[model samples]
Target: MTAIKPGLKLKSAVCSAEVMVIKAPAGASLTCGGAPMIGAKDDAPAGAALDPQAAGGCQVGKRYVNAEQSLEVLCTKAGEGSLAADGTALELKEAKKLPSSD
Candidate 1:
């Protein structure tokens, strides 16, 4: 778990995925590929591998949010791992429907 704020960059410990925090609650536990995420400047452990169950992969340029919608992150680089918070998988945030102009 880490104290994350908007604009903080995090990288996956097991994969190449990277994200920028858009919104995050204090003490939020963020993970990628079933492993805790590290600061962008931090180094990953040697021989780290992706977890099979969390290998759904993340898409570049997509925003993923938690169930309560309190946490959100933007994928800056796509990778073979999925994003999660507190052991729950984060889902892609759907685009808001625009009002039809009459």
Candidate 2:
């Protein structure tokens, strides 16, 4: 687990998913595809495999957030991985309703 802060780009260890920290509390464990994420620039070891249980697909440009909303991440690259924080799956944030121009 590492300290999560805004503007930190993270890459999934098991997949090609990439995300940027939008808002995160200290000491948040960010994971993707059931594997811990690393710094974007960090090289992923060869032959890494994704966890079968966590193989949910990630969408590009989606904002995934935890239940408490204390942690939020913006997906930059798409891949077969679900975003999670502290072992809890992140849900997509609902879009704001637009005003009706009657």
Relative to the unseen true structure, what is the C-alpha lDDT of residue 30 in candidate 2, on a scale of 0 to 100?
Answer: 90
Q: Give stretches of model 1 more than 4 Å off.
A: 97-102
Which residue pairs clash in candidate 2? Answer: none
lDDT scores of the candidates, listed in order: 0.94, 0.89
In candidate 2, what are the lDDT values of residues 14-80, reduced to their tens digit?
9889999999988898988888899888877777779888888789999999999999999999989
| Cand. 1 TM to true fold | 0.90
Writing each residue's lDDT as its tens digit, candidate 1 over 3-84 gives 8999999999998999999999988889999999999999898877899999999999999999999999999999899999
Best by TM-score: 1
Model 2, residue 1: C-alpha shift (Å): 5.9
Q: Candidate 1's error at 86, in angstroms?
A: 0.8
> What lDDT, from 0 to 1, does candidate 2 have?
0.89
Best by lDDT: 1
